[model samples]
Each structure stands twice: as structure tokens, then as C-alpha cells.
Target: MVGRPLPLRDLGFRSTMELVAEMPKVVRVCPNGKGSVVLKGEA
Candidate 1:
């Protein structure tokens, strides 16, 4: 029998923050006037 590796969805806070910080800069805007900016990336 062959074993497959498990996929990791969440990397927790430390790793997640690091990844977010290293991500490319993007222009985020609130079109609905929600006063919140969101990161835009490839779908």
C-alpha cells in the first residue's frame, strides 16, 4: 500500500503572517464603501 501526504490548509498565525508579508503589493479598494481593503490576487 502507498501512503499519501496530508494537505495543510491553515499554517497558523506565525506562518500565515510571514507569507502575507512576503506577498506582492496590491491595490485594494472597497467598492461598496465598506471601509475595508482586501488583497487582490489571481483566481
Candidate 2:
């Protein structure tokens, strides 16, 4: 079966398509009122 949906950080377009399905502790954190997403993961 297909795994979890790929995160935005691992999404890209290149000469070839490689999926970096690294599961991270994602959270909706607004650090100092900045971004909305935080991905503490590996590549």
C-alpha cells in the first residue's frame, strides 16, 4: 500500500523523481509569528 503523504520539504522536480519519505515530528508552530509549519526530520 502507498505510505503516508509526502511532506512539502520532500516535494520537488528534477531530472529524476526521488521520494524522501522521512517521517518527522511535524507541528503547526508559529515561531515568533513566522512560518506555520515545522519539520524536525532527516533527509
What value does the lDDT take at residue 29 in candidate 1?
Answer: 31
Q: How does each model score on lDDT?
A: 0.47, 0.36
Name the best candidate (by lDDT): 1
Residue 25 accuracy (lDDT) in model 1:
64
Q: What is the TM-score of each predicted model, taking all chains together?
A: 0.26, 0.16
**Residue by residue across 1-43, what tens digits does model 2's lDDT show?**
2696545455553221223222223322234556443433433
Query: Worst ten-residue run, lDDT, model 1?
Result: 4-13
* CA shift of 12, model 1, Å: 11
- Give the CA lDDT, 0 to 100, for residue 11 in model 2: 56
Name the Cα RMSD for model 2: 11.0
Pairs of colliding residues, candidate 1: none
Residue-pair clashes per candidate, as listed?
0, 0
Off by over 4 Å in 2: 1-32
